[model samples]
Target: MIEKINLNNILFLDIETVPEEENFLSLDDDMKQLWEQKTQYQRCDEFTPEDFYDRAGIWAEFGKIVCISVGYFVNKGDIRNFRVTSFFGEEKKILKDFSNLLENHFNQAQHVLCGHNAKEFDIPFIARRMIINQIAIPNKLNLFGKKPWEIPHLDTLELWKFGDYKHFTSLKLLTKILGIPSPKGDIDGSQVAHVYYVEKDIDRIVIYCEKDVIAVAQIFLRLRREELLIEDEIIHV
Candidate 1:
């Protein structure tokens, strides 16, 4: 299905996010109440909202993006390289920069965005964060009334799903089953909030996020029945 899409025209991305506040107690009264309600069904009676706060990053309303790593394929004569770059810091700043990149460089009709589970997670998370930060949604991300086919987002997870919609697959599992090197050797998504909030290691998260981007690209190639990219071909920016 994706054989017709040019690899150079695709922008591969992944993001790392953390709770809006460093801790649950830092939330205002109303927000704290809201968070409790938000996680009610997911948390058991044994767990308090404060204990569950570590997972706040999963929800856009209670979380903020800390890093967004983007990678793209480039060619220079006989050389082919995959370059990855990250925009990170305060949530609003990263959102603004990412939105600008989308609006300026990747807004063309022929461009497609690919990431694992991006359609359900990353893409919408960025759009919602943009709105909350008062940043204008870029043309590519402004999905208000567009038809399903009009959306240019490509999700590796969805592509892997084929027609069955009841199951969920993690990127790590897919890589393992497909023989793609794991991107999450150091840490996984569940630890991101802790790493950012406790360790203050945004760089680590950025590296981890970039690894996911590379893995996503490899997964795409696997879908296309192409060979996987070798380690020497990746370039970080």
Candidate 2:
């Protein structure tokens, strides 16, 4: 079934996120308490809420998307080019711009959004952030009342899982095992908050996010037993 879907119909993407504030103290008392409560089970006795604040980006309620990099395949004659672009800056602006892209260009019923673990993270995070920012959710990301097969979203992680719900594979690991180029550079997901808040290098984060998007597209191709994308085929727009 994966082979039946047209590569041109998919919008591949990845996002970089950071905590709403630079530090735990930056959050108001109410939010600080909420963060503590929310992470209690995961942090347990190993780390305080303040220490765990660095990972706040993993949750939409505690973090804001710093960048969303998207790519799509465009076939011009025999040449295949994957055009990549990003939306960064204010959280609201990022969400609004992405919403516009979805509503305007990729709004067709046959269009789908593809990412690594997108259904669990990228898709929902965007929806929640849009609601918080008071932007209307685009139909592509809006999952309300849609049957499982009717939703237009593809997840490389989910595809790799097959039927093992207990299994989890990181994109870096997946790429390595599948012979796709590693996406990691000077920073990784763990350091995104530091880069955004302390180093203030959004460009670096954008590059990292774009690499993941490319990797996701490559992974999907590999799963479908098709050729992987060459670096020369990637265009940063």
Tens digit per residue, CA lDDT, model 1, 125-172: 999999999999898888889999999889999999997899789999
Candidate 1 collision pairs? none
**Worst 10-residue stretch by lDDT in candidate 2?**
73-82
Instruction: Please report, in order, the local distance difference test score of every candidate based on alpha carbons.
Output: 0.91, 0.93
User: Compared with the true structure, what per-residue lDDT tens digits does model 2 show for residues 3-92?
Assistant: 999888899999998999899999999999999999999999999999999999989999999999999999778889999999999999
Clashes of 1: 0
Summed backbone clashes in each candidate are: 0, 0
- Prediction 1 global C-alpha lDDT: 0.91
Candidate 1 has its poorest 10 consecutive residues by lDDT at 75-84
